[model samples]
Target chain A: MSRAGEGHRVTMREVAQRAGVSVTTVSHVVNHKTEARIGPEARERVRQAVEELGYRPNALAKTLVQGTSPFIGLVADSIASTPFAGQIVHGAQEEAWRHGHVLLVTNTEGNQEAEERAIAMMLQYNVRGILYSRWYHREVEVPPALGETDSVLVNCYGRVGAGPAAVVPDEVDGGRRAAEILLRRGHRRIAFINTTTASPARSGRLQGYRQALAGAGIPVDEDLILEARPDQEGGYGIADDLLATGATGVCCHNDRMAMGLYDTIKERGLSIPQDLSVVGFDNQEVIAGHLHPSLSTVALPHYEMGAAGVRVLLGLQEVPAGGILTVPCPPVERDSVDGAAAPPTG
Target chain B: MSRAGEGHRVTMREVAQRAGVSVTTVSHVVNHKTEARIGPEARERVRQAVEELGYRPNALAKTLVQGTSPFIGLVADSIASTPFAGQIVHGAQEEAWRHGHVLLVTNTEGNQEAEERAIAMMLQYNVRGILYSRWYHREVEVPPALGETDSVLVNCYGRVGAGPAAVVPDEVDGGRRAAEILLRRGHRRIAFINTTTASPARSGRLQGYRQALAGAGIPVDEDLILEARPDQEGGYGIADDLLATGATGVCCHNDRMAMGLYDTIKERGLSIPQDLSVVGFDNQEVIAGHLHPSLSTVALPHYEMGAAGVRVLLGLQEVPAGGILTVPCPPVERDSVDGAAAPPTG
Candidate 1:
């Protein structure tokens, strides 16, 4: 441990004295208030002094005077532990830094007591606001301690008129884009493989699949829609049944499912696009990008949700109380989707 | 945004009034200094008042009196954005919380200016210590401003007598274990596939592999050793050459490489643990677990590295100046290793 200068804090007054200027001039320059016209040379000297002294205006002092520190708090269930959801923290942190505030995240890993304790710590830190986030999209009961500050939910929602605003990825739009890609590629018989679990992603994607079919003037085939456990094993378990339907195009619930189907279908003497064009959701880069053919899928917009959550907190974006800000999930085209049509073999 | 009670700070006076005790008694109880022996009834009342009022002792007051806040600062290159490295944050946070200190991380994405600014901010916040971390294992230059406080590097090393201590994963032992598993499984002829890129992981693991073979009295076969890109493509490209070596067991550089080898070798009509037993490193669950046979691989102690980093920072663990603590990487057994040895076929 390098214990040099432990517990030493350089004061603004020191920066002012080093720059040969009044403390008031240093304060105005540091905070960017500059109500009085301070000359450029004085401002440059103050900046140089601050840099040379490695001086930082005290965060504690700022909180004491302004009632809050320039810190945006993000408390999540498992954002730090869960790999796929980490982009949320990255986005929020980038946006917060852009706004001259630091973003601090505390992951409670779904422990109720930890959540409350983390929120209380944020309040003690005098954070500007809290971004209550879940690792995945779901309806969440806002923690009571969060009422002490301006907070908005990310990747989750709550009942109307009962909690803070939310920023979530638009599942329906994501699903629609997945199916429309196959539809526009001249594939009429598209199979929608949805999760067995009842959630916005499952229901919304199925609706979008059917909507795309209806728009194409092609009647919805009930047998073409298959239900699985929303994982690779589930996709593998339902593969034979899927091949029996013989749809030319397949839209999976997520990238994990697509990966499973890819393994099984390839094992059965079939290959993606050459045998059937496949589109997936949640575009998890590890599974999607590394797959043999490289899956084309709909992204989850997790980064956008995190940025939008900060925007909503900072009043840069609007969301009525209990309203949802559904960020768009754009399609990431890769090698999986083939424009050359294949024959249907139902 | 829920703006309820925004900027509200509950004070000791408010808690004293609610608990019917003097400010001095409340202060002693809150700060956990029991110099004045207070009654149990008074303590219970104070606890209740503190909980009900949510009267957290102001952080500024603590910093002013003690010269440092109860916060462990972790500044990393990309712990949050990089999925494999997130366990570092999780482990550090849990340890910090266990010691009644909060862990706040700032990801600078390896920008020098941002790194300096983040370090300066930590000084302003009066952090107890900073855990300077890198996303991957390598040598890192100690940031200049990091000299202001006690600091340690995580998963990276530095010049002795010039920088703080470091804690890194035991890649050599991990590689040795990977080969030992194959050797213990009654396999004589074994091939080790390492990354072409030169790094601690690459060199250390290879050294371990040679050591394992040497311990077993098996002569190292130069032709059996191959190198390629560290990803799946690299693994796949080397599969045919690996088969030509006539080795019954194959050790991979990482899980992604193992995945690539699995695809190609399976395509070539070979099966794991049956025709060839394979083991991988960096037990990335997404790839190693989801593969059809479920890969047996070495697990990187990312979580342990983080916890150890905090222990070093808090002076709970001894890491001599510029010393390296090599944490073990445990082997995760699955279906990839089969003890029922098959014949070596070229």
Candidate 2:
């Protein structure tokens, strides 16, 4: 609405000439390139001249000529409310910047329509690729145009006309890691609790839990597996059910659910790592560190997943269709898990 | 290097004529605006025709003519690493989308140069406005061009020069609310622990603490006030220092430092609310819910600020230069704070 050239219109060419540098140098300065070393005095001069001249560089003119930007688009599903989603965006942005790309991000509030709108807008801007993300499990019906674009789905796997790869955490691997930690503590009565909402992540984690117990030569108890909501309250309510079933160790689907378990443990006059040891997935910092005993959980390296998403979009990595790239989940041990002393045998 | 027409190229105009509608009507369908009342069969015909033709609408032309976009750009200091930053972004994106505006987001890693670069990129894309965000306290030197553009700064109190308006949590008001809560619970010996970092927020919160105590006729003890680094270790180190001074209720700067206090309290074998009542700012879900007694905290309405930022950028509100629009902070009561059965009788 505020049209330029209303008064004195200063151009980028003039700033370049005044600074005794090429237009490219001025462009780099405007774009904030770290590699370009402009002296303090020169930097000041350019700043002053630009300030005095009222020069605003045209981003479209510069980038349009370049044909494509190193910038990738990351369209997340409501990170402002959820912390985990933010970590994914952060990871993606860091990687994009390090690899000479800026992220063009958007948030779709778990609405299919909104997602379609965001994708359309990003494509219009001609972003190099997209990183479609969701906090919970849901089917991401990729827009038709998305088939022609390069995108990687984070935390969810999707097929876009046999193109557009998805980079998701190995939920099964994460579950197995939690089980292994519990088994190492010499606990056989370990319980697995997850949200009732059905998705690949939940089922995959369940499979891993069963497999881990089998590998440890312990028979799996179906009764120990509790399906709850995906939040702290969900975990809290289900913890009582687990303790009632005489479970000593618990593996939560994610950190929020784990936090809930702590509440139930505290209310029931039980202590962590002593009465009940807890393990969770998704090493969210606030969830991992804030608890009284400090929850020992599995870290799904969201930052790596984000970086990987960008790499997939840039064709830096050959992502096979239908072959989901599941990154390994590592257990972060805190004070939550207390192992039983070994029995005298042999 | 994938040239249009080199591979199968499908333009929108062809699809429009084939669908027996104007190009504008076809655009409405593609953009998912169903106000035209095209029958289901017609819609299906358009989808089939699009599939058959490989029609990809030309976004470049549409954007140029529009001059303004439905996309609102959000630029944060750093998103990936910070906890609350993601929540703030989510809030803004939610509000933006609700208002039929798509969000265009970028991260600046707290680098002034990177911030400027991100701003330029947003401008080129012709976003409706920009939302500049900060998760922590830092002296932000805004680029000059931002003043001329429609933009708003988040978690920022004041501006250096002529710039867009800022939306930050009313730290002083929030602090006042926290103090009021403590006062109601019959706590007189309250201690304020803040970061020594030279930031407006830190100083502003300190002022609020002083103001609240003064207003309540409770003598402010200088010795009870302590400064530490803004992290878990910082909180842990300062817990002993505060407790040693005989303060009954402690208010931490943010949730992060408060978490450290939980660890220190446990190490000291101190029970929460009974031995020492701890109140933290920023109702970080991880901190507020995971603690033994669940720490009581002030939740900054990040979503409200985000929605307000959009309003400011859209010229829905007019603010004075160097002035700030403080978003309200509300207290979330949990188990951490234990008050007397009744208020003390004067």
Candidate 3:
């Protein structure tokens, strides 16, 4: 193989020279332009020269001529948001690779003009389609530039009746499964510590909590549904209130919150499961997997959402316009929650 | 002023029609090809039409005509390796965008053929350069294909005298600062908990610890330096041994190790800063920031390393061949370490 000098790429002319053919003939053979007849021996020589020189033909040029490109664009509000963004990117990348496409990811960091510029860049690059995503689940307006491409939303939804297909985690289902984990462990007086942030998750998870209690034939206790800041400190801040409810087990808004509860409880001479079995949401691997006793939690299905978005964008899957597709949030069981915690003292 | 249907980008012909000019004139105006002698009136009309139509000219096409691209390629072993990948991507993205280049990131996940294919894709796309990175700091072989373009390594280095310039964290400095943090807090009998992993961090940090202690006029106690698996459980397992050293303060290999120590110490009826001051490395935001008292520790300088990598790759910074640029790991002060921890009773 030939090695190019610094700041150089082997050109088609190099291949033509090595192949003993005109540059135009080399181009036609390499591009497979059927009408541009080339002798068999010359075509063979061109192929050998290409392999030897490690010559890479311009995919952009081919895209212009053939009207397609093996590229997908992922435009996210922020890719630096840990755990969430990484998994989503991984899922989409794997799926796109399977379909012989590469992903061009650009993080806009929620800046309006940056988002538009990123979208414009994708179009200019001749991306097959765009995956408009968020690091968190939320409702968003479809950027007008997105209308020029086949697009799908991942981990977020477009406003009702005003956007393309989307794939988001089943938030309510995630909540119900978390509650069920504790309910099955014989904890009736369960509390749901929800985030104070007003988003789909705040409401959806709460509704699921209610459904779980109702399904278990336990009377709903409005006071048991507590609100916190949805972080470790928030969970710590609400610890006294959460413990005062006399719940045997609690479902935290997230792993961070669960971590906080763990600290206060331990300080209070309490132990997880023995005194209070706990479950958390967003099985963020770093926190959930490393916590003392580890955390049993529900995952947001970020990977699935990313993969599904690509499928929809590439026409491998079909969804009606304005229809929001949902993927299940799988429950991960670990050491934090258990089935044999004795009922709270009468 | 106009939105194309799905998969349709506004073409030069459309702009020409809207401006009442020929397509050739519109192309020339958008391409900024000064050699074309289009009249000012026609150029002005084309510009107005482009703005009104929300037209995005093909950057790839322009690259073909002008011999340059406004894109940088970043191929990492894995971008989904939380915390590390995200920050590196953020830093590189910001630097590239500042230079009018968009980043096309791909995760090869250490597959050799995939790496080759990714490099080929970048070449075909006419990328201005490539920023090859690893989520973790280590030595790597520069792929043969990388010789064909401008490239820089981030958080990793190539074999001696064999590849592009690199930016890596100053692991030795990170370790020394972590020990100094505890030493400045009036803790003389300090222990160092090092990871068992054989890497730059393990050896470099131990050297730093020795330097800090020596600088304090204290003799190095080899017995006080212990090794573990570089995780929370490892710290927990080594607590008895760590406690046996009569060290009032300790510097952990990383944040996860510090987390483990927190659990075991509290379980043994002890408190941080009150009984045993603690310092950790990595400063992983999720674990370090949310830990009970919040961890005071050293950072890995992932962000700065990433930004520096881009600067060097773009020729904005000069680095001698095979020189590994080191970014300082700044110490973050938090509540975990303090000067008031009572000396261990003899």
Best by lDDT: 3
Judged by DockQ, which candidate is best?
Answer: 3
Model 1: TM-score for chain B: 0.87
Give the lDDT of residue B115 in candidate 3: 86
Q: Indicate the residue-level lDDT of A209 in model 2.
A: 93
DockQ of all models, two decimals each: 0.47, 0.28, 0.74
TM-score order of candidates, top first: 3, 1, 2
Point out the higher-scoring one by DockQ: 2 or 3: 3
Clashing pairs in 1: none
Pick the winner on TM-score between candidates 1 and 3: 3
lDDT of 2 by residue, B1-346 (tens): 2323312335677887777767776777887886777778778777766766666665655554554556678887756666567767777877787677777677766677777777776766666778888886455666655654577888774446545578888778888877777777888888889887877668877888888899889889998889998777788888668877787788888888887887667566666787778888888755577666788888887777877888777777666556578777998988888873321111
Which digits, one per residue and each the tens of the lDDT, describe model 3 over residues B1-346?
Answer: 3666778777888999999999998888887889999999989999999988778887767777777878789887766656787778888888888888889898776788878888888888878888888887888888877778888889888888767888888888988999999888788889999988888888888999999999999999888999998889888888888888888999999999999989989988888878889899988878898888899999888778777888998889987555788889999989998784554432
Candidate 1 segments exceeding 4 Å error: A1-55, A320-322, A339-346, B1-54, B320-322, B339-346
Fnat per model, in the order shown: 0.46, 0.40, 0.73
Worst 10 residues of 3 chain B by lDDT: B337-346
Steric clash pairs (candidate 2): A80-B87, A80-B90, A90-B80
Candidate 1 residues B170-259, lDDT tens each? 988998999998888788888889898878999999999999999999999988898978888898899778888888888999888988
Q: For candidate 2, write residues A1-346 as lDDT tens digits.
A: 2334322335678888777777777777787876988777777677766766667765555565656655577877867656667777877887787787878777775777777877777676667777888765455675655654666777777654554568888878888889999999899988888778888778988999999999999998888888888777788778557866677788998888887777666666567777888898888766676566778889976777888888777778776657466677788999898975322111
